[model samples]
Target chain A: MGDEKTQVHFGILGCAEIASKVCRAINLSPNSILRAISSRSIEKAKQFAIKNSLSESVKVYGSYEEVLDDPFVDAVYVPLPTSLHLKWAVLAAEKKKHVLLEKPTALDVGELDRILDACESNGVQFMDGSMWYHHPRTARMKEFISDPTLFGQVKTIYSSSSFFPPPQFFETNIRTKADLDAFGALGDAGWYCIGAILWAMNYKMPTTVTALPATIRNSDGVIMSTTVAFHWEQEGTTATFYCSFLSHETMDVLVLGSKGSFHVEDLIIPYEESSASFNFTSGASFADLHIGWNMKEQEVQVHNELPQEALMVKEFSRLVKGIKDSSIRPDTKWREVSRTSQVVLDALKLSVDSGFKRVYI
Target chain B: MGDEKTQVHFGILGCAEIASKVCRAINLSPNSILRAISSRSIEKAKQFAIKNSLSESVKVYGSYEEVLDDPFVDAVYVPLPTSLHLKWAVLAAEKKKHVLLEKPTALDVGELDRILDACESNGVQFMDGSMWYHHPRTARMKEFISDPTLFGQVKTIYSSSSFFPPPQFFETNIRTKADLDAFGALGDAGWYCIGAILWAMNYKMPTTVTALPATIRNSDGVIMSTTVAFHWEQEGTTATFYCSFLSHETMDVLVLGSKGSFHVEDLIIPYEESSASFNFTSGASFADLHIGWNMKEQEVQVHNELPQEALMVKEFSRLVKGIKDSSIRPDTKWREVSRTSQVVLDALKLSVDSGFKRVYI
Candidate 1:
């Protein structure tokens, strides 16, 4: 392991769109390589490998387990449908392979807990594929929000991520079925919004959540739309978030404070060269007139051009390399993120199941 | 009832700041008159009446019951703390006086229902004083949102109204005491936001609600911060709302549709002279580049300078005058408003009690 260039070979469990991004990142990153690709159809897997320019050194498997059994593959990235996340994550853990699972991690808390336990017991690293948290821009936003001088007493946070889903995206398979824990906009897109809020707010699990889900169905009786509001509190600060997948494309985060408000607009898969503007109000009065003073706009330019998937892979590689370092314990952060996501997902399900009642976590 | 003007002489149940505005409006409006004022002390009531330049013809009562019993008073305005709202409202209805109660008509749905029954049995109109609904600007907004051709398909509606409570406003008294049903932020402010969304969406009850309440506290313990999210659906449109008393003053509403989105800044109590802008994006694609055209900003010149209390008085006056008209059915509208408010309040409580479980109306 000294200088043999300890490259961690990876196998993607599904040839999904997200898998393409991860494969591209692995191919581009120095510490990792795309070793194999698998799909339900061997033809699809071979086509993906060929299109991505994988050499004869890489294998295309017809089944997920075949790819998992590849001794050369040190880890697995599960880009399968949400319902399949837990099963494959646990399988990967049982095989003693690191797991980089997609957003949501699992359909519900029970599944998430089981996967987490399996990974812990097997001594396998587990990380949710939340690229936004690894993005440098998010780190900057988090730092700015936490700075008392710059933000001056956080008051309210309003975030929205809404876009029309791919036509028939909700009707095809497990993703659209309500019984599978896949329904409406929240499960598909709102999860990301909730994750962003939780991360920025320092994993402040909402004490109680009253959610109202707007249910919309496609022509085939599949759910197509869901809107949710999350009321969150930590310490003395209270934040409310609005998310939807029914409206036209919109991705923005607004933070209001005692002194002023800052807004990060168009944050979805945010461009690498994107910059955020801050509007600072300077006065005691909440009036617009007072807000006009020192209402200066400051822009923070983010120059990192690394694709989000690459950043996520880079972070995971760094964590794996640092596993032997006594100070570098990934389990603490992993547990917090996993628990927060599970709590939110459970709260959401409770709300949905109880007709959108307030559920305490 | 004939050519002679029949004034609805009214008395205030509390010497609230809103009551002062109502007294002024009563003096200014021709169809109504301020007959008396009441408080815990006669001297305070006298001073209030004198400061407001009420005529010597007007009387000052020492207690709320005195105002209710005064024969000169034909109607009553209850602006007491939230917990006391139901009690006083019930008393006013029992006294056979038409009542214009403030927002959050009652702490709970049962209380509201009882108030409604009492009002109906006593043959008096019990209107929830949601003054914004009567504003000419709100009427225009309602008309715009309802117009299918202009707006096309309504996808989602989001609104936020937050403000800090007055100092010591959350003491053991009615509005702040948890046991007294004085919800911190939801009861104080969230209700208005909910009412506004309901009004805009044509009284569509939310199918389900998930609410997260702040920690409950009193002088001895933590009283919960009131925060609520209501998800409502009608036809295919989904509406989400966030309201709190914890946020720095904010009032905003965003309505998203297929063709475009309409945004109302400072919607709770908008600036008298500001314009309402509509951003229209027309195209088959959901991308921003497909945005076609936007209508020019529409400036709404509000010539009327009366405050909310004044507006409520004027609207009530009109309702009272129209009560005798064969074509008018103000009680029907009042009942609807009361019912809607009750449903929202009840749904919020259910969310809280059920650990923020989703509850259908």
Candidate 2:
């Protein structure tokens, strides 16, 4: 085992837009291989396999369950709509296969907890597929924030991720249907804001949150547009976030402190060609929109041109191979991620139902 | 009546810090005179009158009712704590006097509605003391927004106003008690956010709102911080606002449009000494924030250099003197302002009680 390179064969549950990128990453990596692909339609699965030039070795399955039952697959990536994340993640765990579930792992906390229990009981490794968290820029951001000389004492955080949704995407899709645990901007984009805030605030769930959800509508009636507010606390710090699906593409996160501030421009999907950079404050005096240090100069450039999904897959492979030491187990972090998502979604639901009431966690 | 130079004698209901400037303005203005001053203590009232050089002409009263009852006083300025605003404003109305009440006219809607009714029945002017709304800059801002060639189509509106509160101010103050109509930063400073958003969005009440409020508390259980998300909808337009009292001093308002963007720097309180300017962007093209045809000109300049309270008094004096039109009564705006505040505060309370449930108007 020491001399031999560990190999993990992977299958994808539903071939969504994000799955293609993950598949490409798996095919390119030496430690992992794309063993199978599945979709509700066999034609779609076959086309995916043939297009990737994996038809000779990779199997195509019509039913997601058939892919999960394959003994050759060591892990499965679930990129189904948010509503189905819990079901397939639990099934993969039951089959003794590690699972890499996409962002907003589940729609609510109750379901998320059940998924965690299933994974733990089966001794299956589970990881939330948050590729941004695996990127070097995220670590650099954490480091810059912790540095007293650079940021002084951390104070507030503001983030926004707004983009125009495809016109057809909002009609009866799992992501837009309220009965299927669908929320518009907050569920789709607001999770990023919540995740970023929690990460910067040392994983402290906001003690309370008061949100104003935008009144958005399609032919279908009122959908959420934007959520804006301050996340307050009895202790620690406060943060603010704005998320929208009605605007032009924008992804930025800014962190403010007493002495200076640090921000990551275009955080959602990093600019395709270059490494993400942070703008830090240079001096004691504050100026509008300033940047200070480069992580590359500090020798923190872990991966230069690798795709974000590739980086995440590489990290997950290392964790499964027992080559990486982690403070929280991959399984534990998976549960925590899902739980945090539920807390945020639940709070947002409460805000919407109660006409933007401030809810305490 | 025009030749008579009609004068309206004004009085202070509480010798609060804000009242001092009002006294000075009354002394300076040609159409109004400071007739009386009152505080809980006669000694304090006398000291305030003396400090402002109201020596022999201005009468000092021990109780607030005495000032309201004074026949010489045509209007009374109420700068009392939030809890006392409704009671005193109603009392002043009953005395047949016009009233200028500070922001958060009342903590809840019921109290605000009663005050409005009393003022209407008594035929007295009732204005929320948000004097900044009366500044010439506001008119200029409206003009900029209305001009299609300048701003094109308005898209998004963002505003934030945050400042630290004195330590003693949080202890048992009317602004900090939730049951007593005190509700953290939302009540203290978030009201300004409401006013700014309503102003920018053309005074449209939100069709729906979803908010997340922070649980902010001092050592003695006073709420010190809050963040609120207000999603407003009218026709097809939507706007978002973020307001807090816990963060550092920041006052910024940004309005993004399809063809261009307009930004108001230090919106709540612009620098008095320097010129106030904003940036306008139209797609790839950009220009200085303009009001009508002007570019890079000062947006908010008060040539008189008077305190905000003084500016408010001077404007009210002009209204009384028939030199300025009173048709745009502040009482009309106060109704909406107070109603919005009630909705927001009620939403905050519901959020806290229901563990951050979605609330509706």
Candidate 3:
């Protein structure tokens, strides 16, 4: 968060496809340095480094443990499949390297809790790799929704994330393989939608989660597409989301309060890397004779100095630096939000398995 | 449809708030003329005519039957409450006056069927007053989703409409009165959402309809806000929608297909009265390294020569003129689509009443 001198050194576990994005992010982040990368096949790891044009100073490791054992690596980014998250993340935390894990953080909340405990016991930072949370537009949108006078009491939200994967991905990708990702689309895409709802509620978990009818799964019992609804009884707020790998790419979030609403079409990834915009309306009443709106919605554009993932890396690195130089405790907000998001995801999956039943959390 | 000389004359059944919008539409439509208006009190009807600046040739009647009985009036526009639709619409059909009925056409499918039967027997045209269906943007959007190469198979749709009504309106309006608009928010706002989904699916009804949990009701047992999910097993297509009267006003329709998506924020009422725009993406693929999209979504703008409601009036008038001049039988497509939409709404209401169970339609 301060200067490059206090930079946090990061080593990535596994040369997964997503690592390319994160590797570039680590390079772009001012307070973060790419230290190493490890993969089961050292040849694949070397290829990835060369393809991504990594600096010559960055070392490549043959095993995940080699990267974690490196004393110079201040933190580790785990982009492996969901099944390997628990073991590698816990091992990294136990090794006293701050952990930034890819989302659907675990197979279930129990595993997520175990990883959090490891980080807590070892006094290292923990953060889920949900890049959208670090976007500057996200903070601005939150400020608008939280305004009582302009937005009123938040009442409802609808979020969805979907992408039509290639035919080969369905047959060969780890996401569709049950033992590898297990939760499939629910774990991969649904995680972002669930996190969106929780983030809009300011980390307040819903009291009930109900799966919508028409959940589709592959032959291997992996969810391909589904929709779920959430209810917060005390706040009288409700949210619903649809996720899938069988549909076109779409990521949207719409939040409605008493007096205003906030809507964004590309929530997961902005349409442009340099700037993003969202629609906001306050006190929108009907026009004369109700033919149109009396108040026009404002499309507020937010400029980004760095990409969202880079900002995420910078934020995580800042926390790791605080623990290293200032003896500061790790931020609990990130851990709490990630844990609550996983809890909702588990309840949704349970509801789907139970035939669209309402699951109380 | 033929010429202004063959213009169809219209009579309004009540001075409902919606009538103000339609009255102007009838005047703007070249093939339609507002002939008369009726209310419980003649004074109120006269005041409505004056307030809407109706032509001096337009007559004012004290009773709905008076307008239906007017032989000079070729069609009757029924904007009465949902509870009054069956009685008034059936009477208008029996009088051989083609009927344009406001949405939430009937309390349930039984009443809708009765109204349809009366229209069929009398050889009169019937159309629902969903103004958005007439928007030029709607037709263009449909053309995109129906494209196989650009959009592919339509897999899912999400539609929602909500508005924060004044506190007093909830207490006094017919929508919140169980005996008047018995379905409440499900009738008022849910109708448009259901219609949007049905329109996207080419008016095909889903096999199953399930009400989502988090349904809120007033003390009168009228729904205040709710969400419903629709599933078509044969087509492997699904839809979900949320409707409310207690939250910030929002109208959004998002359709996801195999190759592209169609999204509109203000589906029901555009931000402007003259033209509207919607976002469409075709072949949206992830960029290299999956950091962003390769192609940006295009915002397609559609200019309207006539207001949506005016276009609706013109279309209805054209059908009325065809039946009157050509001795043609009533077009069944209008009745069929309205019937399917009502059937889905009935199933959703039944599901909600039965504790959010799946109702097979």
Per-candidate Cα lDDT values, in order, are: 0.65, 0.64, 0.90
DockQ (CA atoms), all models: 0.14, 0.09, 0.66
Compare candidates 1 and 2 on DockQ and give the better one: 1
lDDT of 2 at A73: 86
Residue B228 local lDDT, model 3:
80
Best by lDDT: 3
Task: Please provide, for model 2 over B178-239, each residue's C-alpha lDDT reduced to its tens digit, 9 standing for 90 to 100.
Answer: 55546566665667777777777776666654444444555544456544444445444545
Superposed on all Cα atoms, the candidates' RMSDs to the truth, in angstroms, are 7.2, 9.1, 1.8
Residue B283 alpha-carbon offset, candidate 1, angstroms:
7.8
Selected candidate, larger DockQ, 2 vs 3: 3
TM-scores, all candidates, are: 0.68, 0.62, 0.97
Model 1 - which docking category? incorrect
How well is each residue in A225-289 modelled by candidate 2, as lDDT tens digits?
Answer: 65545564544455666666565444557666544455554566664424655555423321221
Better of 1 and 2 by lDDT: 1
Scored by TM-score, the top model is 3
Q: Indicate whether candidate 1 or candidate 3 has the larger TM-score.
A: 3
Pairs clashing within candidate 3: none
TM-score of candidate 2 relative to the true fold: 0.62
